[model samples]
Target: MPLTVNEIARLLKVRGVSQYGREPVSQLEHALQCAHLAEQAGASTALTVAALLHDLGHLLAAERDNRADDDLSCDDLHQYIALPFLRGLLPDAVLEPIRLHVDAKRYLCHAEAGYWDNLSPASKRSLELQGGVFTAFEADQFLQLSFSNDALKLRRWDDLAKVPGLRTPPLAWYTDQLAQVALPDNQAVYQRLRMLLC
Candidate 1:
């Protein structure tokens, strides 16, 4: 299931931007911002990559029309769809952090005391879908998962990436970055299923 360079290129080419929201940023914009912020915070390349692609589920979710708020908000469609597609395409060390990024957000909201109030409506809604507030046991479960620290860092960066007028890096940058990342062949099939956010 590992992604091929061609597959990654196509996926990146599909435009992860969205038309939803008053601010209206593309998915790729959000991801790149998160990656940049994570790098500024000294996150590992793997963690930065996780931040970059964590919302990949949205592409699949949009295609199925399973997106909350008409592709604006919370849902686990990406987790259900994108994760499986990425299984062999990305290393477990890489993919596991992406899988658990949302959980890291949830955990932070509940454990950090004041973090919950800062969550976006989409995040809150998705939290409900993800089973409301995560229990201590759930937090522990995520903590034990691979790349927990990186995921946490990326999750924080993901949230911070949303400032208005923050000039977004072009998709071409990500496309170039993907060239440096190894991917498997046969990734093109997955591209057909993603929602074109651009």
Candidate 2:
């Protein structure tokens, strides 16, 4: 079921306070930091919203299943979990990056020197659970996916987002960004709007 923007905000406010996979920051903090970085980088509103909501699946997982991050033994597949909730609510430009960010981390471990070494301990652990570094062919395959490069950029922001005590814009700001890119995917809306010009 798709979540309302208010529902998403409430989810973050309520469940997002828990620790983010043993990272120094809470899940909400991590999200805010990633979105802040994207905004500072002059990313598109869609991309910034993607950054803000990338880890939304994590909140949903715990909320629905009552699983603590500490209780998980293996990959939680959090990247894919947010899709059903966000599919029609957000555009593919935003959704695709959220879906592919974990693979982006794997691709980075393969394509970038020192990338794996820089991963935080929690990130490193999750990477192992997420299937580790991509092979040469796997990296190429991942590159072929739409928005893979954007996912890489998002992954970098995700990695840096665990910083403690970082201040970021409130969730409301990103919710407005979400609204900006939440335009209908159908051409009808565009066609109808075009007729308004005199």
| Top candidate when judged by TM-score against the true structure | 2
The ten-residue window of minimal lDDT in model 1 covers 66-75
lDDT of 1 by residue, 1-198 (tens): 345555645654564556323335666667778877876777665566666777776665665564432443445445446677567556665677777777788789768987889887766766777766778998888788767877787778877777655775665665455544534343455454443532
Candidates' TM-scores?
Answer: 0.78, 0.91
| Runs off by more than 4 Å, candidate 2 | 184-198
Instruction: Tell me model 2's lDDT, rounded to 2 decimals.
Output: 0.87
Q: Model 2 Cα displacement at 7 (Å)?
A: 0.7
**Whole-model lDDT per candidate:** 0.65, 0.87
Candidate 1's displacement at residue 57, Å, is 1.2
Model 2, residue 157: distance off in Å is 0.5
lDDT of 2 by residue, 1-198 (tens): 366676788988888899988889998999999999999999999999999999999998888788886544777789999998887678899999999999999999999999999998878888888998999999999999999989999999998898889889998888888877775553335445556753
Clashes of 1: 14
Q: Residue 188 deviation, candidate 2, in Å?
A: 14
